[model samples]
Target: MVHTKLKYTPYFSISSFTFIMIRLMLLVCVLVSFAAAIPWLSPAYWLSPRAWPCPEDAAIAPCTCYADDDLNLFMDCQNLDSFQQLVDIFQVDFPFKKFGRLQISNSDLRDTLTAAVFPDGFMFREVIMFSNNFLDVDPDTFLPSKTELTFMEFSDPTPNFPLPAELTQLPELREAVLSVNCSEIPAWASDSLVTLTIRCLQDTEFPSPLNLSHLSALHLHHTNLLGVPVNSFVGSPGLQTLSLNNDQLASFDDGALSFTALHQLDISSNALTTMPQLTCGCEIQWLLGEDDATMPLIGIQNVTLVCDDGSGKFDDIRNVLDQLC
Candidate 1:
């Protein structure tokens, strides 16, 4: 058997391998150079912090790209004339798990904030809009399916205020502060409202049949109220705090003190000459009243009376109540 001797050329094999490696290196360099010339070709080059178009002394870092959830916390479209801008900004589906508070205050929002502006599952817990005229919005403009909203503060500039009935759909609402130009309470309120603070109720009657069974705090400060009827708070079983200070209340009917669960009551700095016999039975802890009567409160602690006589001598009201308790 004649076996042929195989030619072993190590130099030739090494030369071929080196040539292939050199060609691969040259190809990689050309690709990289081409990517560097284009603005949107390389992600690393696009994301470089030095390439951002922001001012040198800016407090925030320059950002050309944003996550889907970053824009939900704050949206200020003050005097934005185009409706498309409003729709584009609010149309993004913001992740609810990341956002907790949203503020759209002092914005000249036009008719672009309809119900379709926000996603259906938006869950904002707090929303504040001071001096935004949303009265022209449809009643169902903010009809969200599920909202974790706890508070809403809206200050309107127009006198003919229109409260939407869709507010009652929010099951978790706790506080609503409305500073409107109207002189009376909006008739379109729901029973789910617990804390209401109205600052501009002038020449308006305390709307009769106010459902306050679940209300805990009520503030009517600086609202021109002539007189609250006796039966205004008749059904508020869970009322704890009542503030009617700095109003034109000449007198309170006996029904004002009918809340059994009341704990703190403030009726100071009003035009009152006599105190209403609050029938809350010893549950009241703080009674801030005006000292215009001859006899002080017989039983109450932490009493602060604002009197014209300047004597602060009604300190003995708590001592009398302590003996009875």
Candidate 2:
């Protein structure tokens, strides 16, 4: 039997196996590199552009994109036109956790946003919607179950025809600034509002059961108010600052404000002939009244009388207000 010696070239076999292992390792490295480059490889990787894509477009010029983690501070989203665009950029799906800040000011948006657009427990801290021409706003549009919003601003140049009742449901809101028509104030506002500023209120009479017990400041500037009940500020235990400057107010119901926490009061440049005897006590610091020499200093620290004195000293009402501030 001739035993054919098969060529047992162990060296070549070992070299071949080593080459295959090296190739496999190199292939894995290349795959990982490609996977890492995918995010930067395409400009389309980011969401599409709408009315306002970048923060810069939203009047927050020189906008900076925040990471998912930095949500403790306030988020400014002023002047962003398209609400849908914001939802895409934030990657906010239903049942969202928490969002930092959102600003949608001076936009043409007229509809209310739904909870489905936000994450669960939609924790939105600050929201500003100023100068939007929204005729109507649904209260439920901002209500996120179990979420607590701190600050909200809705200052529109256009009149808000009527606001929904759902706004009263947001008990977690702390500070709010609403400069719209008097008709928009929901009946429940006095109950839930803590700090409120209502400018240009056209109504002649105040709402019943004024539940501003927790209100700190009340701004009713540039309104057509003729008279306010003396007990208007009765239940407002935390009332600190009150401004009724530049109004057509003729009289304030005697003892109209019994605010215990009353600190600053401004009723300057009004049609008021006699200043309401404010029993605001020594807590009153600043007093602004019409420019009349008969202006009595009722324990008020600084008083700016806006009278029709021929000296033109009282003509600068706005400058006086600024200096007081």
Best by lDDT, which number?
A: 1
- Across residues 283-312, which tens digit of lDDT does each residue of candidate 1 receive? 332342223242323342333333313454
lDDT of each: 0.56, 0.55
In TM-score terms, candidate 1 sits at 0.59
Model 2 Cα lDDT, one tens digit per residue, 1-325: 8998887656545578899999999987886677576543334434545221223233334223343444343345545566565456455222234556766665565655555555455566677777656555545556663256767777754445223455556766777777765543443454556777666556545654466667887777776666676566666767777877777777666566455556567777776666555332322222323443422234333322324244534326434444554
Q: Which stretches of candidate 2 lie over 4 Å from their true place?
A: 1-64, 67-97, 110-122, 157-168, 189-193, 201-204, 275-325
List the lowest-lDDT window of 10 residues for candidate 1: 56-65
Clashing pairs in 2: 77-103, 95-119, 95-120, 96-119, 96-120, 190-211, 230-256, 290-306, 291-306, 291-307
